[model samples]
Target: MSRNIYAFLAIILLLLQNCSGQKTDTKFYDKDFKWSIQIPKDFTKVSAKEWAEKQQKGENALEETTGEEVINEAKTIFVFKTDDMNYFEANYQPFDINIDGDYRENNRNVNHALYQTFRDNMPNARIDTLSSTEKIDSLFFYKYETKIYLPNNQILDIIMYSKLFDKKEFTVNIMFTDPKCGKEMIDAWKNSKFEK
Candidate 1:
């Protein structure tokens, strides 16, 4: 249970989640957040069936580790992947305003909890970088970057950004082991536009 199996399960779930025939083509838009991001044309959407199966596996793995089922009520906005194991997924989950009523601080707290879980449970996980702030287009996102060493001697790099929009949490998860794909993803996300 101290192994990085949960991390591997996550990869399977994400790969299955958006392996459908759907493609981003150009820009992905969301009216609730008033946001749009540029994505590569070659990305394919994850199938619902695959997403569900993989998601459950991930949840089961978590339950075994934490001794409780953390309910996943987050609704996926989209999940896209390429043949290179590069993935991008967006989801919305509940965000409770803290007692201090600070939006960004609350966002940062959520990211901290996730990273701490990785450190506490996964033995070989290395937290390359902790919480940082980055402004993409007009949105300010609290970022968390981590590198998890797999049992097969491969590295899994994950970059996650979260923000609160209208009192809800919106997150973008980018997972890639390839350096080239990571650069490409960073460029695409950096150049994304927020539609007025």
Candidate 2:
């Protein structure tokens, strides 16, 4: 199996595990990470510890990814999902982007690598080029949508928004088990504020 699929499955399972519901509008803030996002009153927000416990209690499908270690690093930002629990409204995480020489060129190379990896893993995968290069507030992002055909003919729509800042990258991921939430997810992504 491709490592990208393993990484992607790990992230999806991490999001789906040990999810609990919460009321009241809340602002998710991580002081050390210097990032915050507004989670609506109807949504639910939980801790990464809870998800870790859930993964440990289960069969751990992520571990079967052929030696791809699942690193549950107490993620500062947990997933924010809709009230119905059908889709993820918004998720934020910061990563150390390995941009070796030129930032833009390296970033493009990284994207290309991921694209090829995903295609290699899932031959039936349908990818759409939403925005190869989109700028927002002086930030350049490569955005795209992909439809992965799962077992039993179920399809998952994932819209990935990634930005390279200095040597770090911040990803704002929105997923829909049902494709109808695409517009709402895009709106939420646009309204989200990321403080560097």
Candidate 3:
């Protein structure tokens, strides 16, 4: 009986250790989006609604879209930053606009729609198309490098990488401030895969 108790205690300790272990990496997954990506420990993930509420109260503030846009399929927008500096916002928004025929044809139309949306969203930002279309595995991606001038007269370099799958579109907009962190963020975006 004493030996059994000791074995159980050891197992409990191991479990507790694992539970208390520092998270050096983090992953965010959404079934509706049918996508997943691994991010670093320093980046904090917050939903769009949660972020807006906190911002209204002046705490841990990050803004992606207006709170009005934070509805329905846009609800779970994930904001990531380090030390009060926002690096990017990642989210998947549903695209229910029907395409006529083939998957390839629909994909082309979807890509064009996504690109138009991006431009419409950031009318002032100067955009440079890094790669219009690139195929990886079963996914086609569109990338943009934009220079956005903030109100404070600061020019921010941003990367907008997007992909469409499972009737939804995924976007990762990363601020290219720190080269190392920027590379990691881009790699995370590229490494992201959707299963559906």
Q: Using lDDT as the measure, which candidate wins? A: 1
Q: Write the per-residue lDDT of candidate 3 for residues 1-196, one digit (tens) a residue.
A: 0001111111111211211122236787767656787887666554444444433321111112112221233333566654333365665555544642343444454344333433555466554444456554367766555555544554555565565556655656676445667777777777877784
Q: Which segments of model 2 are wrong by more than 4 Å?
A: 1-8, 14-18, 29-36, 53-75, 83-131, 150-153, 194-196
Instruction: Give the alpha-carbon lDDT of every model.
Output: 0.65, 0.50, 0.47
Better of 1 and 2 by TM-score: 1
Please state the error at residue 188 of candidate 2 in Å: 1.8
Candidate 3, residue 55: lDDT: 32
Screening candidate 3 with a backbone cut-off below 3 angstroms (N, C-alpha, C), the clashing residue pairs are none
- Deviation in angstroms for 141 in model 2? 2.2
The alpha-carbon lDDT assigned to residue 67 of candidate 1 equals: 65
Estimate the TM-score for candidate 1. 0.76
Residue 25, model 2, lDDT: 73
Tens digit of per-residue lDDT, candidate 2, span 1-196? 1112222333445534446656547666655436566554565655455544543532245444233454442232455566332344323233443423554554454455445545654567565434466664455676755666665576667666665544444555566665555556566556655565
Pairwise TM-score winner, candidates 1 and 3: 1
- What order do candidates take by TM-score, descending? 1, 2, 3
